[model samples]
Target: MSNVKDVIVKLTDVEKEFDGVKVVKKLNLEVRKGEFLTLLGPSGCGKTTTLRMIAGFSNVTSGEIELEGRNVADLKPNERDVNTVFQSYALFPHMNVEDNIAFGLVEKKVPKAEIKERVAEMIKLVQLEGLEKRRPAQMSGGQKQRVAIARALINRPKVLLLDEPLGALDLKLRKQMQLELKHLQQKLGITFIYVTHDQEEALTMSDRIAVMNDGVMEQIGTPDEVYNRPKTKFVAGFVGESNILESYVTQVDEDLLHISLESGKALLHAPGFKNEEMIYICVRPENLLLSETKKEHFSIRGRIVEHVFAGSVIKTVVELINGQKLRVARHPNEEEFEVGTYVYVYWHPKKAIIVHTVEEQIYNVIEGTTNRIYEQLGEKYSPSAREDSHDQ
Candidate 1:
């Protein structure tokens, strides 16, 4: 909730490699004070490696890491102003909850009275007041996790690093803990750098998400920004369900451009595209509309291959004449389309997002420059800008 723009942690051109294999490449990031920033990606995407580098568990191969504007590249784990809570909980099997929370302060040789007070405060902070006597073996997964967090926060570090701490819990407990963790971070006003591969968890808790892939940061923005306006094809496909259509520009009409499917069977309208240019268009499943009657523009004929009744919405798979398949999500209240039934799939031009192709993404990685496709589209065609235009 705090809007302070203070930079607590900065990673400048950070690179990490193991045995000549690069894991994190030219990564630049800044964690703002009192913000819940998540490093989100699939396994082996260098998210955990990045977090470990910040915590001083792993050394960076190149680049500098600064904590509170002071270079910490040479600092030891205990010397840095940060603490980490890992997925394994890392709670000592022989230690009780109170003892585990008090371990760090004890190591620091804090006075007995002060350590007791600090441990009590941490217990209340993590809502483990009544479980002080329980050991890791006696507590549930969620309880053990809280103990680990309390232990990490007991030091009052400038930043707290969490690497998939909730991954071991059941779905119901994980969802519950997500809200609790977000609320706790805001309450403590600590800069949290969380790492998770779960897209839903990242979206639910992060103020801003840094999406990484193959040793590079694909995108970093607020949840809505990354979800609605993904900068790359990988971001769009990985962050959520999307329908990617390959199309080529056919005609240009002032601000509006007409594009046709690669097979030249279906036509669509977009803003600010060049003629004869091939591009990828992304549309979220919920954005696609199904109609019995043809729409005025951007309408395609498809036969429903299957319809699934999810609790809140109906998911229908439609196949075009060219063999391209699209998944559509409709509100449960809408009429359902039976298999083999013909339907019109339509959407507004504003809902379509022009994203980078696989080749463009590769080129950007190789050249270390912004994609030319994005340069051509410009700021006016950006996801946020397009949303504003649609609202107007």
Candidate 2:
């Protein structure tokens, strides 16, 4: 159990509206002190809107925001004990790095000696020690973003809000900055609220992630919780690569659930569902097992139609007897399956995440076409296909 003393920020029934569209709806969240929290979602999902409301830039249409046990609803942006690092970095081009970092101290009327000390400390903290004399125009994208973060941190605000601070950097630089920022957050012990659309970035850095969709929060939990046990279909689809299989509930008892797929029946052990209705099952890309032989209870035989080589993993697309296309990921070093190889697919029951909705017919048509292509290639060509391929 977590304690209130650990909570640095809390939102209760928080909501915001723009021109009568409910951009944020009845949101409840708690941020532990010194934790790195991220608001993650695609564009127009209300993640940015929610962050702005907390920063005091966007007013809350309803609900309360409490920071360190004080309601800050009436406070202006500058008056609130929070600082924001924008995507643009927003550094004054004319000001040198040292001065830009010192600007906040100057605004607060800190003594000259103290401001100098703080600026120097910030430069070292962000590992920009010797670059203080350079102007924003002279810095690299990563360096400029570091300067922006230094500027925000110099004030020593109770909370820091970062809005896609790494968006402008290239892939390599973005990944590098992610580690730097995460380490910096842990060292400083300041509550950090970051916003981004990148699911991988959020999973890599956040202590907890709030997944929002279409102006509503889908789920909020640790990366493991959200990733492994998504509460809704939107969350399952949005967070990572998932293969959703439509299934009908056949039996339900306590934590164990039995479901029947088009190819075969399998069991799921999620505790929250019951009543034996229709549901959807979700399996992660890596959780799926690719096999050459059929197994008891947990098996589906299919013809491999497409094999794509992604850098670290090989993606195999298989079509089951019922024309269901299932994707499985395997290591590059593993034996490669050809375009028309017949194989067996198996996955653990616990690895499946049962969902409650049906997929569109378009999926069926796309999968159906792939299966037919494999069949047309002729099954007698392969040594192993004589028994497996023609049986379908």
Per-residue lDDT of candidate 2, residues 1-392 (tens digit): 36989888899899988899898988888899999999999998888788899899988999999988889988999998899999999999999999999999999899999999999999999999889899998999999999999999999998999999999999999999999999999999899999999999999999999988877777789999999988777788889888888777777878877777787766767775655667777898788887787665555668889888898999988888899888788898888878888877768768988643223324545756765765777675443464476688
Off by over 4 Å in 2: 251-256, 271-275, 299-301, 321-324, 356-392
Candidate 1 TM-score, true structure as reference: 0.89
lDDT of 1 by residue, 103-169 (tens): 9999999999999999999999889988889999999999999999999999999899999999999
| Model 1, CA-based lDDT | 0.88
Highest TM-score: which candidate? 1
List TM-scores for all candidates, in order: 0.89, 0.86
Error of 1 at 288 (Å): 0.6
- Candidate 2 pairs with clashing backbones: 280-355, 282-353
Worst 10 residues of 1 by lDDT: 262-271
- Clash numbers, per candidate: 0, 2
